[model samples]
Target: MAQINLQNVNKSFGPGVPLAVNDLTLTIEDGEFLVLLGPSGCGKTTTLRMIAGLERQTTGDIRIGERVVNDLRPGDRDIAFVFQFYALYPHLSVRDNIAFPLKAQNLPTEEVNRRVMDVAERLRITHILKSNPGRLPGGEQQRVALGRAMVRQPQAFLMDEPLTNLDASLRADMRVELKHLQHTLGTTMVYVTHDQIEAMSMSHRIAVMDRGVLQQVDTPLNIYRHPQTLFVATFIGSPPMNIVHGRMVGARFVAGDGQFWVELPPAARQYTQHDKRVSFGIRAEDITVGAPGGAGMAGNVVVREPLGDETVYVVSVAGKTLTAKTPPRIRFNPGENVSVKLDPAAIHLFDGDSGRALLPEGWSKHV
Candidate 1:
């Protein structure tokens, strides 16, 4: 296992095109599963390629273990890259595909055969060893691709959305298998993916990127609960955090439309003294919906989404739409009147203009 480090790394296509990665400095510890997460065209893939020596950084240094391998060829990097498409040879059998890398190095036939069979058994693909890539299921094909990478026994593994092509159920299953595989092998892994679930579920630490810039690097819980920026607050959640643009009026945050307000607790008083125009954010699950006559902000339900175990209700309040995730049994029809209660402790406050969280010092310390 090896620790990978990138220091002051920047990549650009040319003058007109924007830099793909911008002054990004991060470290992937030995035997760590670090995930690079972001939307499309966010330079995640570029960063991974740079680490693999597939794409050279325009400026700055990349260090694998103790060596500054900025000029090393990809073949000499001692890292294996598993592509999203599996990239297995169509004509070669699963055994042959997994053994191809060993064969190229001209290892003894017995050694290569033993290694291939071992990986196949570990991946539970030994039954399909004689099958071609074309005949295997998406999950099996992905396993074969992983097997090929495993047989190399490289210092680290870099994957670029390797599970993106599988069906939803299959992808879910493979995620478990992949995480277990990584734990068993104890190899340093740097994974790139846009799927929040994948990043949240599999990573030891998540690096959230946007427009080639690193947003926040933290555990899944920290990223979700204490997002450093408005972009991250809205990006990491499933239904996304519901944000209301408002101005502070004494201890209450009044919505922009002047139709509704949420009372701020004493803990939030310090943030409103100078910054009146603030953004109030709350997760869908943090808002409670009550019966029409109950004591809370009144709103009209606009949509009801019944997820298996939970239900999401979108309500229009103060000219803004806010979503509330509630128990599945708590049914409310569209146009029905309801009361909404925001959890003061769970509330997130941010600056309207700068879009940065205005966390209280005590709260910040806890986070």
Candidate 2:
């Protein structure tokens, strides 16, 4: 296992077209599981391709371990790439497909058979070694593809949305299996995906991107609790954070048109004096909904969605709609007047003009 580094990377298709990746400098530590996460057209796949030597960068230095692999071919990079779709041969049996890479290197027959059987047993596919991949189920076919990559024992593994073809339940199951596999093998992995849940659940650190630019890189909890930008605040969450357009008035944030207001925490007050126009952000779970005429802002429930264990409520407060997540036991109906309380300690503040977070001094260094 080796650490991968990219310095001042830039990828552009042509003179008139926009760049696919821009000045991306990142390092993937040895034996680390790093995920490149973003929406479509965000250059995550391009970055992965560059690292695997499948696509060359217009200007940059890419080093895999101690070697500068800018001129090397994909096969010489000593890394295995698992494609999104299962790329298995129909004519070949599962055993032969997993052994194909070893055979290509002209290894001894006994060594090849031993390695294939070991990987098959580890993946629990030994029973299907004689079956054709074309007839197997989607999950089984994926395992075969993974087996093919694992048998190589390369320096690292680069995967590009490897589980996108599976159903929701299967995808969930595979996520757990893949994380366990990575931990057991202790190899460096660079995964590319647009799904936030996959990134959140599997990665040691997530590199969030947008329009070919890196947004933030942090652990799952830090990324969720303290997003560095507005884009991250809205993108990483399942229900998304509730955003209210407002301005800072003294130590309090007053909604536009002067309909609603909330006090800022002591730490946030230091930065509020300079930036008058700010956007107030709070997570769905941070807002409390109760009966009307309480010690909080007054609002009316606009819609209610029951989601088994929990319910999500759409509330209209001061002519602005905000979402609140609550337990299913706490029931409320549409058009019902309710008291909404915002947790000041859990609130996030962002500069309205720049869309950057307004955080305390040196707050980002800890994470």
Candidate 3:
């Protein structure tokens, strides 16, 4: 069992260049699955490489279990790195590809064969052991790569978007397989992916990053329901959270365009200033749209998109575009006026200039 820790880690391409990872500090418990999730060039992969000894940090300490391994080489790190592409030799058979790492270590021939067949059996690829890499399907090729990684019994696994090359259906299938594999092996895993669905489905906890900075770290449910920053609130959702520029006025939220207003309880005043500029945020699913002249904002539907699972409507409320998600069976044509009601408890308030969640201490109960 191995626990990985990174403390005040920083990396840069050159002396005068900007940092790739800035003051990153994180800890992964032994046998835990930690996912580094972010978009391209956000430094997630770089952080994984630093842990695997493939890249050096400008300043920090990387500890594997109880030992500092900053100067160690990749091979000596006791961690297996899985690439996005299948790195198998085209001429080698599946069994040979799985056994190559053991052979390189000069283990006994019988031992190498035993480990290879064992991993093949575990991966359910024993029937294709003799097939060449080029002859295998994409899913089977990935299994071969994983078999190779598993045969080593490394302290941890660092995967850099290993399912990126597969089709959508195959990628989803592999996600289930990979999660089960991690559970069975109980090895420390630092997985890198930009796909939120993959991260949400597989990780025990997610580390969200953006532009070389850590945004928030939490469970998938918490990340979805209670985003702490504007960036995270906007990035984590599919239709994205609707944020309207507004101000708090005597128990009322008035929009910047003077279109409509929302009644706020007097108790919420402590969370906002009098007529202070603020951002009002609510998820698409939390808003209900219907006929006008009710307890909500009156708006005209600009467009309706049917997504089978649900219908998304773009509504013009006081000249501001707000997206609302409705039931799949609900039908609305463009130019239809609708009343939009936001779940009172679901509303989010963010500071206008800093874009930070405005929550009173002990705010969990309210949320």
Candidate 4:
């Protein structure tokens, strides 16, 4: 329900130790469902806790809407946090559990009942109203936790992998439910998850973090198709992007292994001028594997994984390994020589040593 902003935020566990969060600055728009995605030890959770006032930031300031809340307690932030581990009162019935937070505030019994049932219905947990927390299924108990948060109708929702404890099928089901729930309510939700799929499907925009630094912030498709860093490129996809050693040859990019052929997009070639030893990156899904002559690079199949929906092929050319994915119904096996072609427009070029993007022609005026 509010926009949040961080300015020069800093946190450290001790002197000389690495900053858990390093001069972090970000903005969360009102009613935006933003997801903080990264692997373990990435400081995403540390950032979330800092926002909630649950973890004190060693430096900088945090603001919700128009007011700075750095001096406020967690309870005063008007935000709800749904963590991985549901902290429900085991002895209480679902109805009582949902009403517990209100009870703590000493609300009248009639008002408590009104808030509890309203939240239960909103989360579709009305049927389990009377069941004790100990008797509920993981998914049901999850709803109770969510309902408890919903009871307050707080200004923001911070969920940190709340679906991590459920079975795969239930987790998937709950993801859909949660998406719909957020859509219907339109609250400012900051969800933290290591699962890229969850982040991709649920977020309006995603902030990717790594080793205490923010990597790239964009829509899922842009992050997938145009990652700003080598780490982001490697971390976001399943099968991952294939990065190869190569050098610029006049207008062409020749693989370092000395047998692969590549053509650069006319637009990308502008950056290749006066630079050699660049890193070429392409996604597994973007590479095309074929026989000796198919208007693409020539290669040989070395291995094949026949997944039900698509086939994954590992190809070899000049002793370099390249992965290509195609429709599962079409199959190819190892030991057979092949040719591959990449979509020139889809290729990404990186500064070999720096792992930073090479600006295309007309991109950097001084280049």
Candidate 5:
């Protein structure tokens, strides 16, 4: 396995176009599963392509192992790229498709057969080895594509949303299988996806990007619990984080419109600047919904969405709508009054103007 590194990488199409990737510097440890995660047009795919040697960067160095590979051909990069679509050859049998790379390398017939069978067996696609890829199901075709990549035994695997074409249930199954496969193989992998769930569930670490800028890189849990930027705060969660426009008044956070206030926790007080504009953030799961006129801000439920295991409540509080994710048992109807309590300990603070997290020193110790 090899470690991949991109130092101060920048990609630009031309003078008129914006840089696709800007000053991106990141390192993927040997045998680590690192995911490039962001929404569309966020330069994630471009970054992946650059690492694969498919697109050359306009600036900076690209290193795989100990080699500077900026000018290397894709085939010479020692990386296997799994495209979003199952790019299996329609006319080739699954077995032949898996053995294609070995054939290109002029490996012995016996060695190619052995490698193909091994990968097929590991991927559990041996039963379909003789089947033509054109007749296979989407998931099976995907396996064929993955098997083809795996049969090569490349130094690293770069995947671009490889599960996007599968159905939701199949995608979930593949996520588990992929993670297991990565663990078993212990090869370096760089996966690109806009699906936060995929990134959160599969990656050892995630590099979040926005508008060509590298926002943050950390473990899935750390990125979720302690986002370093406003975009990350709202982007990584399912229901997203609930943010309130406000400013710090001493140790208290007062809403911009002067509707409500929350006392900052003592641990966070040292980081707060009196009269500084900031955004108060809390996850939907962190907001507690209680009986009306209880020990919190009173709000009227505007909408109730039942999501089987849990119910999402959209409450109108202080002229702002905040979503609360509560247990299905804690039912609340629209138009009903409820008390919404923001957990003081779970709150996140960000600079209102710059949209950057305002975290106290040693904050990672808590995460």
Candidate 6:
């Protein structure tokens, strides 16, 4: 197992140009499953490549478990990488492809055979050992690709969206299999995915990046519950968090339409020395829906979708529109009026002008 540490690591394409990874400092624990999540061109893949020595860092140092590997080549570093596309040798059989790394290391032929059989059997692709990539389905090819990586038994594994091309059913099945494999191997795994669902489900911790900046890093639940910035609050959750322009009315926070009020506790109300134009954030799940009581925020049910397991609602609340998820199969027809309530504990307040979280220095997290 390897614990990765990056100190002031930065990468750029040209001299004196904008950096692709800007002063990123992070510590990934040994045996931890960390997912790097962001949109395309957000520097996630750049960071992963740098770790594998595929790309050189313009500044700072990279350490893998006490050894500073800044000058080492990719082959010299003990890392196994699984790319988005299966990079298997088309002419080689699956067993040969999985045994390639062991051959490179000049290991005993019997040992190579043993490791290949073990991982292929575990991935449920043992039956395809004699087949080539051209004859294998996408899912089977992915397993072979992963088995090839697993054979080396490297200190760490780096996966760059290896399952992005699979079907939905295959994606679900593989996710469960991957999680189990990581646990069984007990290896340090760094995964990259643009899908938040994948990051949320597979990662022990998540690192969120945007515009070449590392925004936040924390446990999946902590990151969702305590987003450090407006960018993270908007990016990490499904259906996204609902944010609206509002003003602080003494102890209460009211929306721009002045129809709804957020009941802030005394501590939360006193969070700011004096900041106006606040941005209020609440997740779709935090909103409780009901028939318009004529007193709450003015809204009409614009759309309702029953997904068998739960109902997704699109409500035009106040001057802005927002989405909510609920389980009650209430027959509130479309265009019917409805009222919405924001849970006190679920409400997140930020500074509108600066777009920064506005709270006491350390007690940003409230009871």
For each candidate, give its TM-score against the true structure.
0.94, 0.95, 0.94, 0.93, 0.96, 0.93
Residue-wise lDDT of candidate 2 within 82-199, one digit each (tens)? Answer: 9898889879999999999999899999999999999999999999999989999999999999999899998899999999999999999999999999999999999999999999
Give the lDDT of residue 337 in candidate 1: 94
lDDT of 3: 0.88
Query: What stretches of model 5 exceed 4 Å from their correct place?
Result: 361-367
Candidate 6, which segments miss by more than 4 Å at Cα? 15-17, 254-263, 273-275, 359-367
Error of 1 at 297 (Å): 1.1
Worst lDDT 10-window in candidate 2: 358-367
Clashes of 6: 1
168-275 per-residue lDDT for model 4 (tens digits): 999999999998899898899999999998998888999998888888888898888888888888888989898887788877777865566576766677777644
Ranking by lDDT: 5, 2, 1, 3, 6, 4
In TM-score terms, which candidate is top? 5
Highest lDDT model number: 5
Model 3, TM vs. native = 0.94
State the lDDT at 329 in candidate 2.
95
In model 3, what are the clashing residue pairs, if there are any? none
What candidate 4 gets wrong by more than 4 Å, as runs, is 255-257, 359-367
Q: Write the per-residue lDDT of candidate 6 for residues 1-367, one digit (tens) a residue.
A: 8999989999999976678999999999999999999998889999999999999999999999889999999998899999999899989999999999999999999999999999988888888899877789999999988998899999899999998999999999999989889998989999999999899999999999987799889999988988877888999888899888788878777786677666676668776434378888889898877877844566778999887877878898766787888886755778998987666667788887766777643453464
Assess the local accuracy of residue 195 in candidate 6 as a C-alpha lDDT between 0 and 100.
90
What are the per-residue Cα lDDT tens digits for candidate 1 across 184-298?
9999999999999999999999999999998888888899989888889999998999988888888888886667787787767777654378898999999999898887788
What is the lDDT for 184 in model 5?
A: 96
lDDT of the candidates, in the order given: 0.91, 0.91, 0.88, 0.85, 0.93, 0.86
For model 6 the local lDDT of residue 47 reads 96
TM-score of 4: 0.93
**Which regions of candidate 3 fall more than 4 Å away from where they truly are?**
265-268, 360-367
